[model samples]
Target: MHELAIMESALDLALGQARQGGAGRVRVIRLRIGTLSGVVPEALQFAFEALAPGTLAEGAQLAIEQVPACFWCAACAREFTSADLIAQCPDCRELSGDLRTGRELELTSLEID
Candidate 1:
Protein backbone atom coordinates (compact mmCIF):
# COMPACT_ATOMS: atom_id res chain seq x y z
CA MET A 1 0.00 0.00 0.00
CA HIS A 2 1.02 3.65 -0.30
CA GLU A 3 1.16 3.81 3.48
CA LEU A 4 4.34 1.71 3.35
CA ALA A 5 6.07 4.29 1.20
CA ILE A 6 4.83 7.12 3.34
CA MET A 7 5.95 5.40 6.53
CA GLU A 8 9.36 4.74 5.01
CA SER A 9 9.73 8.38 4.11
CA ALA A 10 8.71 9.38 7.63
CA LEU A 11 11.31 7.04 9.10
CA ASP A 12 13.96 8.49 6.82
CA LEU A 13 13.15 11.99 7.97
CA ALA A 14 13.03 10.98 11.64
CA LEU A 15 16.37 9.23 11.39
CA GLY A 16 17.87 12.19 9.66
CA GLN A 17 16.68 14.51 12.38
CA ALA A 18 17.97 12.19 15.10
CA ARG A 19 21.40 12.05 13.47
CA GLN A 20 21.48 15.80 13.07
CA GLY A 21 20.73 16.21 16.75
CA GLY A 22 23.31 13.60 17.77
CA ALA A 23 20.60 11.35 19.16
CA GLY A 24 21.72 7.78 19.69
CA ARG A 25 18.20 6.50 19.17
CA VAL A 26 14.76 7.74 18.43
CA ARG A 27 12.34 7.53 21.33
CA VAL A 28 9.19 8.58 19.62
CA ILE A 29 7.75 10.05 16.43
CA ARG A 30 4.58 12.12 16.50
CA LEU A 31 2.43 12.52 13.43
CA ARG A 32 -0.53 14.71 12.61
CA ILE A 33 -2.85 13.08 10.04
CA GLY A 34 -5.96 14.82 8.86
CA THR A 35 -9.13 12.88 8.12
CA LEU A 36 -9.04 13.96 4.48
CA SER A 37 -5.37 13.09 4.04
CA GLY A 38 -6.42 9.59 2.85
CA VAL A 39 -3.90 7.92 5.11
CA VAL A 40 -4.79 4.83 7.12
CA PRO A 41 -3.25 4.94 10.58
CA GLU A 42 -3.36 1.17 11.08
CA ALA A 43 -1.61 0.54 7.78
CA LEU A 44 1.03 3.12 8.59
CA GLN A 45 1.65 1.54 11.97
CA PHE A 46 2.02 -1.89 10.42
CA ALA A 47 4.38 -0.53 7.80
CA PHE A 48 6.53 1.15 10.41
CA GLU A 49 6.80 -2.08 12.38
CA ALA A 50 7.79 -3.98 9.26
CA LEU A 51 10.31 -1.47 7.90
CA ALA A 52 12.04 -0.04 10.96
CA PRO A 53 14.55 -2.85 11.51
CA GLY A 54 18.10 -1.73 12.30
CA THR A 55 17.16 1.93 11.85
CA LEU A 56 17.52 4.67 14.42
CA ALA A 57 13.77 4.42 15.00
CA GLU A 58 13.70 0.66 15.42
CA GLY A 59 12.13 0.84 18.81
CA ALA A 60 10.54 4.21 18.46
CA GLN A 61 7.01 4.83 19.59
CA LEU A 62 4.68 6.25 16.99
CA ALA A 63 1.96 8.66 18.10
CA ILE A 64 -0.71 9.44 15.57
CA GLU A 65 -2.84 12.54 16.05
CA GLN A 66 -6.04 12.56 14.07
CA VAL A 67 -7.23 15.87 12.66
CA PRO A 68 -10.78 16.46 11.56
CA ALA A 69 -11.69 18.02 8.24
CA CYS A 70 -12.78 21.64 8.66
CA PHE A 71 -14.36 23.90 6.11
CA TRP A 72 -15.46 27.50 5.88
CA CYS A 73 -19.09 27.79 4.92
CA ALA A 74 -19.86 31.03 3.18
CA ALA A 75 -23.60 30.55 3.37
CA CYS A 76 -23.50 29.77 7.05
CA ALA A 77 -20.80 32.33 7.67
CA ARG A 78 -18.91 29.94 9.92
CA GLU A 79 -16.46 27.10 10.00
CA PHE A 80 -17.43 23.52 10.69
CA THR A 81 -16.08 20.00 10.50
CA SER A 82 -16.92 18.06 7.38
CA ALA A 83 -18.44 14.64 7.86
CA ASP A 84 -17.95 13.50 4.26
CA LEU A 85 -16.58 14.48 0.86
CA ILE A 86 -19.83 16.06 -0.26
CA ALA A 87 -19.60 18.24 2.80
CA GLN A 88 -22.51 20.58 2.65
CA CYS A 89 -22.74 23.15 5.38
CA PRO A 90 -24.93 21.80 8.14
CA ASP A 91 -26.48 25.12 9.01
CA CYS A 92 -27.27 26.54 5.56
CA ARG A 93 -27.02 23.46 3.30
CA GLU A 94 -24.40 25.14 1.13
CA LEU A 95 -22.94 22.97 -1.64
CA SER A 96 -19.76 24.90 -2.22
CA GLY A 97 -17.30 25.99 0.44
CA ASP A 98 -13.62 26.54 1.15
CA LEU A 99 -11.63 23.99 3.06
CA ARG A 100 -9.88 25.49 6.07
CA THR A 101 -8.10 22.45 7.47
CA GLY A 102 -7.73 18.77 6.63
CA ARG A 103 -5.65 16.74 4.12
CA GLU A 104 -2.63 17.16 6.33
CA LEU A 105 0.00 14.44 6.66
CA GLU A 106 2.87 15.91 8.62
CA LEU A 107 5.52 14.86 11.09
CA THR A 108 4.91 17.29 13.89
CA SER A 109 7.53 16.26 16.39
CA LEU A 110 10.23 13.74 17.28
CA GLU A 111 11.42 12.75 20.72
CA ILE A 112 14.91 11.34 20.66
CA ASP A 113 17.72 10.52 23.00
Candidate 2:
Protein backbone atom coordinates (compact mmCIF):
# COMPACT_ATOMS: atom_id res chain seq x y z
CA MET A 1 0.00 0.00 0.00
CA HIS A 2 0.97 3.65 -0.31
CA GLU A 3 1.41 3.71 3.45
CA LEU A 4 4.75 2.02 2.95
CA ALA A 5 6.00 4.93 0.92
CA ILE A 6 4.50 7.36 3.38
CA MET A 7 6.18 5.65 6.31
CA GLU A 8 9.45 5.53 4.41
CA SER A 9 9.29 9.25 3.93
CA ALA A 10 8.36 9.83 7.55
CA LEU A 11 11.24 7.71 8.74
CA ASP A 12 13.59 9.59 6.49
CA LEU A 13 12.51 12.85 8.04
CA ALA A 14 12.75 11.45 11.55
CA LEU A 15 16.21 10.13 10.86
CA GLY A 16 17.31 13.45 9.49
CA GLN A 17 16.04 15.21 12.56
CA ALA A 18 17.66 12.69 14.85
CA ARG A 19 20.97 13.13 13.07
CA GLN A 20 20.73 16.88 13.34
CA GLY A 21 19.98 16.58 17.05
CA GLY A 22 22.91 14.24 17.63
CA ALA A 23 20.62 11.41 18.62
CA GLY A 24 21.58 7.82 17.94
CA ARG A 25 18.07 6.46 17.97
CA VAL A 26 14.51 7.53 17.67
CA ARG A 27 12.22 6.87 20.63
CA VAL A 28 8.92 8.06 19.33
CA ILE A 29 7.31 9.46 16.21
CA ARG A 30 4.07 11.40 16.41
CA LEU A 31 1.80 12.06 13.50
CA ARG A 32 -1.34 14.13 13.02
CA ILE A 33 -3.64 12.43 10.52
CA GLY A 34 -7.05 13.86 9.75
CA THR A 35 -10.12 11.76 9.05
CA LEU A 36 -10.10 12.95 5.47
CA SER A 37 -6.40 12.35 4.94
CA GLY A 38 -7.12 8.95 3.33
CA VAL A 39 -4.17 7.31 5.07
CA VAL A 40 -4.91 4.19 7.08
CA PRO A 41 -3.38 4.07 10.56
CA GLU A 42 -3.12 0.27 10.55
CA ALA A 43 -1.38 0.30 7.20
CA LEU A 44 1.01 2.94 8.46
CA GLN A 45 1.79 0.87 11.51
CA PHE A 46 2.47 -2.20 9.40
CA ALA A 47 4.66 -0.17 7.11
CA PHE A 48 6.62 1.16 10.03
CA GLU A 49 7.14 -2.32 11.39
CA ALA A 50 8.40 -3.45 8.03
CA LEU A 51 10.71 -0.52 7.32
CA ALA A 52 12.00 0.39 10.77
CA PRO A 53 14.54 -2.41 10.92
CA GLY A 54 18.25 -1.48 10.53
CA THR A 55 17.34 2.14 11.06
CA LEU A 56 17.28 4.71 13.84
CA ALA A 57 13.58 4.08 14.33
CA GLU A 58 14.08 0.36 14.84
CA GLY A 59 12.04 0.32 18.04
CA ALA A 60 10.48 3.71 17.91
CA GLN A 61 6.90 4.10 19.03
CA LEU A 62 4.53 5.36 16.39
CA ALA A 63 1.79 7.60 17.77
CA ILE A 64 -1.04 8.62 15.52
CA GLU A 65 -3.40 11.44 16.47
CA GLN A 66 -6.71 11.25 14.68
CA VAL A 67 -8.23 14.56 13.71
CA PRO A 68 -11.88 14.91 12.86
CA ALA A 69 -13.09 16.73 9.79
CA CYS A 70 -14.35 20.29 10.36
CA PHE A 71 -16.20 22.65 8.12
CA TRP A 72 -17.46 26.20 8.28
CA CYS A 73 -20.98 27.20 7.48
CA ALA A 74 -21.41 30.67 6.08
CA ALA A 75 -25.15 30.71 6.54
CA CYS A 76 -24.87 29.83 10.20
CA ALA A 77 -21.57 31.61 10.73
CA ARG A 78 -20.17 28.66 12.60
CA GLU A 79 -17.88 25.72 12.35
CA PHE A 80 -18.72 22.05 12.96
CA THR A 81 -17.16 18.62 12.88
CA SER A 82 -18.19 15.99 10.37
CA ALA A 83 -17.21 12.58 9.08
CA ASP A 84 -18.63 12.99 5.59
CA LEU A 85 -17.07 14.37 2.45
CA ILE A 86 -19.99 16.73 2.07
CA ALA A 87 -20.32 18.52 5.38
CA GLN A 88 -23.74 19.63 6.39
CA CYS A 89 -24.30 22.15 9.12
CA PRO A 90 -26.25 20.44 11.89
CA ASP A 91 -28.25 23.43 12.89
CA CYS A 92 -28.62 25.27 9.64
CA ARG A 93 -29.04 22.17 7.54
CA GLU A 94 -26.96 23.81 4.82
CA LEU A 95 -24.23 22.17 2.82
CA SER A 96 -20.86 23.65 3.61
CA GLY A 97 -18.02 23.62 1.17
CA ASP A 98 -15.74 25.61 3.46
CA LEU A 99 -13.60 22.94 4.93
CA ARG A 100 -11.37 24.09 7.75
CA THR A 101 -9.57 20.87 8.67
CA GLY A 102 -9.44 17.07 8.30
CA ARG A 103 -7.03 16.92 5.37
CA GLU A 104 -3.83 16.79 7.39
CA LEU A 105 -1.15 14.14 7.14
CA GLU A 106 2.06 15.28 8.78
CA LEU A 107 4.75 14.31 11.20
CA THR A 108 4.30 16.59 14.16
CA SER A 109 7.04 15.61 16.59
CA LEU A 110 9.73 13.10 17.54
CA GLU A 111 11.47 11.87 20.64
CA ILE A 112 15.02 10.77 20.12
CA ASP A 113 18.01 9.79 22.14
Candidate 3:
Protein backbone atom coordinates (compact mmCIF):
# COMPACT_ATOMS: atom_id res chain seq x y z
CA MET A 1 0.00 0.00 0.00
CA HIS A 2 1.01 3.62 -0.46
CA GLU A 3 0.85 4.04 3.29
CA LEU A 4 4.05 1.99 3.49
CA ALA A 5 5.85 4.53 1.37
CA ILE A 6 4.31 7.38 3.35
CA MET A 7 5.43 5.83 6.63
CA GLU A 8 8.91 5.27 5.25
CA SER A 9 9.16 8.91 4.34
CA ALA A 10 7.85 9.99 7.71
CA LEU A 11 10.26 7.71 9.52
CA ASP A 12 13.14 9.07 7.50
CA LEU A 13 12.20 12.59 8.40
CA ALA A 14 11.81 11.75 12.07
CA LEU A 15 15.14 9.96 12.16
CA GLY A 16 16.81 12.86 10.43
CA GLN A 17 15.45 15.30 12.94
CA ALA A 18 16.44 13.12 15.85
CA ARG A 19 19.97 12.80 14.53
CA GLN A 20 20.21 16.54 13.94
CA GLY A 21 19.14 17.11 17.51
CA GLY A 22 21.80 14.67 18.75
CA ALA A 23 19.22 12.23 19.92
CA GLY A 24 19.90 8.52 19.83
CA ARG A 25 16.33 7.41 19.39
CA VAL A 26 12.92 8.69 18.68
CA ARG A 27 10.30 8.48 21.40
CA VAL A 28 7.26 9.65 19.58
CA ILE A 29 6.11 10.57 16.10
CA ARG A 30 3.09 12.84 15.91
CA LEU A 31 1.11 13.18 12.73
CA ARG A 32 -1.92 15.23 11.77
CA ILE A 33 -4.09 13.25 9.38
CA GLY A 34 -7.21 14.85 8.03
CA THR A 35 -10.33 12.85 7.27
CA LEU A 36 -10.13 13.72 3.59
CA SER A 37 -6.43 13.03 3.22
CA GLY A 38 -7.17 9.71 1.40
CA VAL A 39 -4.86 7.83 3.74
CA VAL A 40 -6.21 5.11 5.95
CA PRO A 41 -5.19 5.25 9.61
CA GLU A 42 -5.08 1.50 10.10
CA ALA A 43 -2.97 1.05 6.99
CA LEU A 44 -0.59 3.70 8.17
CA GLN A 45 -0.28 2.04 11.55
CA PHE A 46 0.44 -1.27 9.92
CA ALA A 47 3.08 0.35 7.75
CA PHE A 48 4.70 1.92 10.79
CA GLU A 49 4.83 -1.38 12.60
CA ALA A 50 6.42 -3.01 9.60
CA LEU A 51 8.97 -0.28 8.95
CA ALA A 52 10.01 0.95 12.40
CA PRO A 53 12.01 -2.00 13.58
CA GLY A 54 15.83 -1.60 13.88
CA THR A 55 15.53 2.13 13.25
CA LEU A 56 15.78 5.13 15.49
CA ALA A 57 12.00 5.06 15.87
CA GLU A 58 12.00 1.35 16.69
CA GLY A 59 9.81 1.83 19.74
CA ALA A 60 8.43 5.23 18.90
CA GLN A 61 4.81 5.88 19.65
CA LEU A 62 2.84 6.83 16.59
CA ALA A 63 0.37 9.51 17.59
CA ILE A 64 -2.08 10.48 14.92
CA GLU A 65 -4.47 13.40 15.27
CA GLN A 66 -7.47 13.05 13.03
CA VAL A 67 -8.71 16.39 11.75
CA PRO A 68 -12.31 16.70 10.71
CA ALA A 69 -13.26 18.17 7.36
CA CYS A 70 -14.19 21.82 7.68
CA PHE A 71 -15.89 23.99 5.14
CA TRP A 72 -16.91 27.61 5.00
CA CYS A 73 -20.52 28.21 4.26
CA ALA A 74 -20.97 31.58 2.61
CA ALA A 75 -24.73 31.32 2.89
CA CYS A 76 -24.50 30.75 6.63
CA ALA A 77 -21.42 32.98 7.06
CA ARG A 78 -19.82 30.42 9.30
CA GLU A 79 -17.56 27.39 9.23
CA PHE A 80 -18.66 23.88 9.98
CA THR A 81 -16.92 20.54 10.23
CA SER A 82 -18.21 17.35 8.67
CA ALA A 83 -17.11 13.94 7.48
CA ASP A 84 -18.67 14.07 4.05
CA LEU A 85 -17.15 14.70 0.64
CA ILE A 86 -20.15 16.75 -0.40
CA ALA A 87 -20.36 19.18 2.49
CA GLN A 88 -23.64 20.75 3.48
CA CYS A 89 -24.02 23.55 5.93
CA PRO A 90 -25.96 22.43 8.98
CA ASP A 91 -27.72 25.69 9.62
CA CYS A 92 -28.49 26.94 6.11
CA ARG A 93 -28.57 23.46 4.56
CA GLU A 94 -26.60 24.94 1.70
CA LEU A 95 -23.92 23.06 -0.17
CA SER A 96 -20.51 24.55 0.57
CA GLY A 97 -17.56 24.25 -1.76
CA ASP A 98 -15.30 26.51 0.24
CA LEU A 99 -13.10 24.02 1.96
CA ARG A 100 -11.15 25.20 4.99
CA THR A 101 -9.34 22.10 6.24
CA GLY A 102 -9.33 18.28 6.41
CA ARG A 103 -7.03 17.53 3.48
CA GLU A 104 -3.80 17.33 5.39
CA LEU A 105 -1.22 14.53 5.75
CA GLU A 106 1.51 16.20 7.70
CA LEU A 107 4.14 15.09 10.16
CA THR A 108 3.74 17.66 12.90
CA SER A 109 6.30 16.86 15.57
CA LEU A 110 8.59 14.27 17.11
CA GLU A 111 9.66 13.43 20.65
CA ILE A 112 13.22 12.26 20.77
CA ASP A 113 15.66 11.17 23.38
> lDDT of all the models against the reference?
0.88, 0.93, 0.91
lDDT of 1 by residue, 4-79 (tens): 9999898888888999999989999999998989999999999999988898888889999999989888866888
lDDT measured at residue 90 in model 1 versus the true structure, 0 to 100: 78
Model 2 segments more than 4 A misplaced: none
What lDDT is reached at residue 96 by model 3? 87
> What TM-score, over all chains together, does every model reach?
0.94, 0.97, 0.96
Best by TM-score: 2
lDDT of 3: 0.91
Per the 3 Å backbone cut-off, how many clashing residue pairs does candidate 1 have? 0
lDDT by residue (1-113, candidate 3, tens digit) is 88999999988988889999999889999999999999899999999999999998997899999999999998778999988877999898999878889998999999988
What local lDDT does model 3 show for residue 90? Answer: 89
RMSD of 2: 0.7
Better of 1 and 3 by TM-score: 3
How much lDDT does candidate 1 score? 0.88
| Steric collisions counted per model | 0, 0, 0
Candidate 1 collision pairs: none
- Give the clash total for candidate 3: 0
